[model samples]
Target chain A: MFFRRTRSIPEEYLQNIGAHDDLLRALFVMTQFDGRTVLDGVDLAIRRGEIFVILGPSGCGKTTLLHHMAGMLPPTMGSIQIDGKDIYGIPPAELDELRTHMGFSFQHGALLNSMSVLDNICLPLREATQLPEMLIRDIGRIKLDMVGLIHAQDLEPSDLSGGMRKRAAIARAIAMDPDLVFFDEPSAGLDPITAAEIDNLILKLKTVFGITMVVVTHDIPSAFTIADHMILLLDGQQLAKGSPEEILSSKDPRVVNFIGRTMPLADPAKVDILNYVAGVDSRLPEPRGANS
Target chain B: MSPSATESVAILMPSRFDRETVPALLQEVRRGIHEGQHRICLDLREVESFDSAGMALVVGALRAAREAGLQIEIQGVQDSVYDFFSLVSVERLLEEPQALPRPGFIEGLGGLALPLAEGSQKGAILIGRSMWGWVLSPFRGQKLRLGKIAEEIFQAGNGAMFIVALIGFLLGLILAMQAWVQLKIFGADIFVADMVAVGVTREIGPLMTGVLVAARSGSSIAARLGTMVINEEVDALEQMGIHPNRYLVAPKVLGLAMATPCLTLVFCTMAILGGWLFGVTTVGLDAMAYIEQTHQALRTADILAAVIKGATFGALIAAVACSLGLGVRGGPEGVGRATTRAVVTSIFLIILVDAFFVLFVKLGA
Candidate 1:
């Protein structure tokens, strides 16, 4: 006999992103865990059928922002609206219904290790639809084929390689044909060629299915390749929000530094192995004959 | 007038060709193909809406036509279905299905049996190695860490002291009350003291302690080790050439083995005290006289048996918990399952071992 009060949307939330054609929006979202702020005053809107990339370096709030927008985490302040509805303000049943139109691809794939790849893809469809088993299986197979993982349909998630697991996760995300898909580091842990292929696949999904994607990534090249609009985050703050070209040409020193940094070349003259070892073991006792 | 016209046939698709209608429509299409309609034309101009199932049927039909040396064509497809088809290529369906390798009967049976057999063998090995480490640790130059063993003892024994005392006291009171009814009829009401002391020391005290300890300490041991395995701390120890049996399992086994006997003694004392309380208040027996009778009735062998039973059950609990925790698979979910299995298995083995002692003592008597 437990009762909970239904949350109502604030008037300010309605004035912010309610009038836009945005399929997803975050209005001043802030998150704190154990008194440590992970996301601070983040605001953005994802247009319907556009690929919006959340670009950031490691340890920034890119994934945290994605989790908030996906309704997996409640922010400390502000609201997330999906389909023009404040997701947090709705009741549990309404939130669940809203979640049906959204899909999230975890960075680690997060496929249930006990189930096969095909079962993982079919999970949402089987739970939500009244379709026959054969039809569900057919749809599952089609999703697997779309990700080029049909050959691995029967294999467990533990059996898949990193790249294959990512592909399978993507297949599961798109299994319900959701309107909004969140991809967390889609090209991460993939080889250069495989990463490029994933980028191309993202583009293809956007163009053919018109599924709106919000990709969170630290990879500069991958972001530029697939992003229609993007926001760069640094230390839980949005540094820049614009197209890829705009991000590249951004006058902000942090954004420029993040995009412009490259691998430092090693100089042969400065490569002294003995000196390096000596520096590492400075506290070690001198060898018996070293002083002599 | 052309000779090819005899082999060709045309069929109109339903307007709402979806999962519900696809089956009937599919049956008709299959009948046409089965009846040797060589060139089939599926006219979808009338089909306004269709879903993925309908798309799958079309692709399946195209694949079937190619395989059967027949020609199939679809004309005037709608925009939405066309968009879906473009996303999931028809060429994918035309490609041959990959051969999924499935295990045969014998292989499947082996898959089920092998892990159980392996786990049993590993459990035996763990028990053997832990026993050896405990036996040989004193002789080795590196002394066992008394601090860690002492900490475990404090947690497992002292932490469980209150619940054990409460159950012991309640049990003693109930036993005396029940025994008073039968003994008073025979004018042997004084015998209640003897019965309470003997029963508590011989069976109830050790048995209850075993159940309580297994419920409390055994689960914690399993959960800790399982999380350690998940976090790769167990692997880290192995990488550093430190044996897990010596470092992790031995201390717990020794601590619980040492602490359980002390707890059993406490349980026996509390039960005797509870029986005295009931004797003085309800039975109207002289408290000092009841105490003397109880003292005389309890023998050394019975007390030894209780201590031995408590120690054995404690060691068994630690061993079972350690084995299941170290052998965990999957992830956090696997850790939870392992913890449950550890508690159940420990209690089961404890009772089994207690039964063995009961038989041994009866035969000796």
Candidate 2:
């Protein structure tokens, strides 16, 4: 009710990457949490390796939609098909086969804190492949280096900062070199400097490896900056989705209100694009001169 | 939507944020800083409030953005949230000069940790996680969590120590007192020491300790394992095609088996000591005679019986814990219920198994 924008017809629906842009699909899928619908009769498709951000306010179900894509959360009434294969109908064994091609970066970085950065990064390869330990280490090292964490290999995860933990998680996500990587709030709890580094890493993973990513996050700028395609979910249905630029420019009040509030609050009228930071106002003075 | 957020989280913040909402808003702020943009404005119009939770996010974001040398601004907050923020007045505390100071700890840890997890812990942790993966994973799938000899031993043996010691002490005292009361009528009260020594070392000491451990530690294992199973940690493993049980379950069982016996030996000592102190010094039995009778009754077979019971009980406990953990329900509450059930079930099963051991040693075998 607080977000009372009239539902305008989203313009991207016509050229919307809804069908042709679909790399995966679900038919009438539902998930129940305590007889309450966490996800109810949701139908949607996600494209491959495209950094597709799932955006929503808290309780809007951004994360739930992402889990469906990763097969982490199964729908109660519907089927999700990955690469055209119905996930529910497929045996559990087959689902695993599909997962080797997919990677997940959890909100906590899900790095096994019990493990070292290298071990967390190469976990997938060791679990799935018989590649020698040396080989796993080599690959893990490469990815850690990719995340700029090559120096942190032997250290336990407990020692890393919020940004480093995420980078470590990214290393783990890309270790198997899966075609698709799912990032659940890749930028949460990080400083802007570190968060941007992670965002750039997301873009690099896609650009360099051609990996498809489905990110679940409330960070509007990170979503707009990193995502090629996007989907907005509310009450277990797709509210709207399109390219980042399109989603941003659209007059759909729902879209406008969602982005407008979350975007760094500045005088929209006086705010100069060149002068504005994505989440902060440029009006705040530099600290160096004052401190001096 | 991601269950990890609702259920768990991505690379869970290494540690929980001191305040929850701050991190969410901080993330938004970080997004701005990363782009190296000069000015950023965050409108809290829809947010409707700026209490600790809301302000935490805004201030947290501003702090990070400032540290990154980006200008920060807040606009359009409702009365309630803004009032709460002012009430706390912590916003001014968070507001400061630009740029965050990089801590040596963060750089040091991630710098080294990422490599090792990617290297050594992969196989071991995967094996450990997989044991109960099938029963617990959100989607039906293959996975592995438990495996490795040392790990199994630790899970089984170490985790159950507290329960074992507690049971051992209580059982020892109970056995001595009960034996004394019944024997007094026959002028056999002096035999309480012998009875306690033989009974404890020969069976009760080892067996009871293990069963106790099974109940306490086993159930704990089950709950922890169960949650991991349903939460997709197990599925994540299986998707990687690692065997779940051999890695996850094997280690726990073996760990318990190895540790429970050692613990049982300690329990035996304590139970006998408790009985001796009470029966001889307090109950008026001749110390020398009691010691001799106890020695005579405590034969090699008795020791074997106790050790065997301890090992068996340990194995049972580990198996139950691992199985329950793996078979836990889907949600957090479900995982909790499974943990509670695992303990109750494991304890009961341990006692039942102990009874079978007693029967077999005495007659059936």
Candidate 3:
């Protein structure tokens, strides 16, 4: 029987993040699905205990980058190091052990609709810990309380509203008290008020618990609000990486348009239906009745 | 090792204190408690790996100590274990379990019955819509794609041809040999042809074909529709003003109904040919005489019965598959459950419908 040989993290990858002593670092990471490149040679570093945001437009590989960082997707090229340990190079068992310290909250609140919210939250603890059922449930309840969703624990995921589902998902993600949590589009489908509340929750979890967070989202205001350090992705490449203030004041037109929402709106008069209808009529032979 | 209430009982934890090993270690603790040990000291110095079950055992021991007015102390706790305990707050584990209100008997009964009632109602609605699409719609100028129905027919019938033929031939050969052995002593060996023809046409051919098709096409339909429901493709169809029953269920139901009888005809022919082979070579009967005897024994009623039973079984299978598939909920597990239930239920209903056909034939005779 042949086995795929596993390699250890190389020495140079450690030196790559040595400058800032970064906790999580991506070096020239590129991801391609089939022949289509989704993430091009993207490089960024996340310092320990900071709320790092990955901001991009729709289909700009924001989630793809997060998945790669979490060791869910192997990059087409380049290396990702979590605390100077190569995520893709190591053996699967080591990767599994490393992943136990991290949590991923999916974009769709991918809670198992078959189970109650409380059970969903307790699932990780039940699987990973030797804690008694009651103790695990207690931990689950605490997690739900942290997300302000204690009362909705008994309800199924399908019963919860979009915002409530996202909160429930967050509760499940933090159930393990992971050192690092990856949140994918936490504010995607919620109303402004609910979205702001989620942002505040994210801030509170960081400030109070001091858990390092990597948030991937296209919502600019939410990103700016929660992000201590941020990176902007455009067309699968890193456009900019800096503090939120630095990104806000960038001179690039694309960055400016993305940050300030200053793109020109369509002129209604030029796009009117009557104009197009008349234009189409003038180009064709006139109707015999109208000509007559 | 000796049990003493005054002296603390020291137990060294295993390297891998997981769910599998926790039970035996727990039994050891229990045995010590029964042997009059008042204080237990669990040593975790050698422990390299621990799972939820290990923590559960610790919590259980703690709870037991407190209730029994004894003492329990954990020594040399690893950093990983300590981190988990600290995060969850060990005090929270010691708290008494909260009592939740249990539902009344009537409420519990209603809880089980409500889903069943809802499912049956949905199943009825699906069957009605499917009938409308299969039988009524074409007469009313609704143009369902003939290509889709043709594809389903090919899948249900032609795809299953080889297996059906093999089973039918084997069954006929076995049945003829058995009948010959039994009839040879009674000087009725020539009646083997009559028995095989009647049995194959009236019972075995349609029954075996139904079971095979149910396992094959029924599971496929259920899994396909269940995945569609999970992926919101079913909802997409509804959004586009297309009835899922008409678009999806009708083709499958109509195709299976049409194809099952045709398959039964082939199965019956193959089976008679097998019996003829057995009677001539093994039993030393004339081949031409065996064919003539089979023709004389098989009535129009038996052939019609086989076709009718095959069509009914096919329709039932499709209906069950489509209903379960369209009604799927939750995730991939839900799709899996639906598929399993579809195959089991289809097979069960096939046997049931077969029994009913046998009764009807007996009564008609």
Candidate 4:
């Protein structure tokens, strides 16, 4: 539990951010075991009113990248900034203030089953803010209502289906109307209908609050549909960066294989087919869409 | 003057520092610079994110890089992080970190099964929680310690009552029938009444019923509660500021304490009735004759002794059940094991307690 993600008011976020803002310049970066850096040298600008998505393959470390951005994880190198101040530059009082406005959704929703959905949603506020019960309930009701989960507020998280739990978790994450939000693999466990629903909810939040968003997912379709800006990572380094279209058109073989629009010689059977059946040499195919 | 606030500026930001990210990135940088870790690679590998602390660290790193004549490389930068570098001038200044060799494909194969490498961390939590409960005596208050008297009654007495009554009645019948068979072999059939009445009221009724109650209820309480303990729900409560001992164990102990003695009395009554039924039917002894002999045979001490035994056994059974329950290990299987231990221990303890009660009453107290 101690190694888990943290959020606080601007003051607290600032406090935790103390003295660290001077050094950091990377967002959600991880080093490779072999000392060859992956998620290579990614730099991003997530505006206050934008949907920024890091779209990549299963091993591209998009989730790791998201964690870096959200402050759930510490980067080996680099800094994240909020407002004019580097996220870690602010004083403790200011940092705590910042954590209050940022909402993070874990991949599994991670709702506490012992708590009712409403109470689960209310946890961050209870931990961080001294808002009155009535105020908290009102906020919870509003968030749940916005997500169409008002009726399910009293139910335990286990009682709800997978999709409903995400909505409830989202409601909880946004219980404070955070200015910035980070979501991890929102569509991973959900069916198409539910995945689409979560996507739509994400878009709705973006549009309504004009809040900054950083989303991480392997769901290519959802990522393309929702990302205002998308970046791809390969082997812990940024494989490609730009729009969803930019990623699709990447000549990088790793990028081509990941987005699934292009064929790459990953399956051993595919290589055999090319050499024997297609009358081609045993070699990796050149990417068709780099700089397109 | 400062290139107009809106214009993006290139600040020579620190690249790799330590494991932390964001504002703390700069903090580490500052500390390093203060500690003179110049020419540092603000390694982007481990960094997750940062707030102001990261920014400060970056600034400190940059400043250190400049002062120490040490070069800084902010390599492995994610796109979102690039914005910070540019704003701070590191985008224009810092170079990328050096790349080392990659593992060969064969060596890399070991890192596979990430497909199967699902983190089983969730299970560890459940085990840690129960073990913590077992180690920490959370089940202690003035009147409500884990092995304390009140705790035992709720766990043992109430849970085992119905089973005790049923077993006691069956024991009475079996004892009566056994006596009746032998008595009928001779012309002393009427004396079967005396045998059963004395047997049930004095010995078999109290002792057998308590043992049966211990077996039926004690094990069950241990298993059910032990499973709860092992599952980490108890630890979760402690984390949430609710003391598990007070919230979970106290009430159960209190409930069992109140329930066991009453159940024992019921068990004794049922057994006496069972004995009377067997005596009248099998031996052809008139009910009045059986009643008169039983009255002649029975002593107030016997009744007192049995009731007293019931009370003591009830408490003992409860204490043992709770003690076992509180000792639960993680997982469903651990619960089953605890249940078995609770029943065996309760039965053994009940017999031992019964011996002492009878001896003490007969001898002096």
**Candidate that would win on DockQ:** 1
DockQ for every prediction shown: 0.26, 0.01, 0.09, 0.02
Q: Candidate 2 chain B: minimum summed lDDT over ten consecutive residues — where?
A: B7-16
- Model 1 has a clash total of 0
A8-47: candidate 3 lDDT, tens digit per residue: 3356764654445788988878777898999987888898
TM per candidate comes to 0.79, 0.45, 0.76, 0.42
Cα RMSDs, all models: 10.0, 23.7, 12.0, 24.5
What does the lDDT read for residue B238 in candidate 3?
89
| Candidate 1 per-residue C-alpha lDDT over B178-239 given as tens digits, one digit per residue, 9 for 90 to 100 | 99999999999899999999999999999899989988998999899999997899999989
Among the numbered candidates, top lDDT falls to 1
- Give chain B TM-scores in order: 0.76, 0.55, 0.74, 0.52
Per-residue lDDT value at B164 in model 3: 89
TM-score of chain A of each: 0.85, 0.82, 0.85, 0.75
The residue-level lDDT of candidate 1 at B180 comes to 94
Q: Give stretches of model 2 more than 4 Å off.
A: A1-21, A266-292, B1-365
- Name the best candidate (by TM-score): 1
lDDT (tens digit, per residue) of candidate 3 on B109-183: 997566545544565577778877667667867667678999999999999999889888888998899999899
CAPRI accuracy category, model 1: acceptable
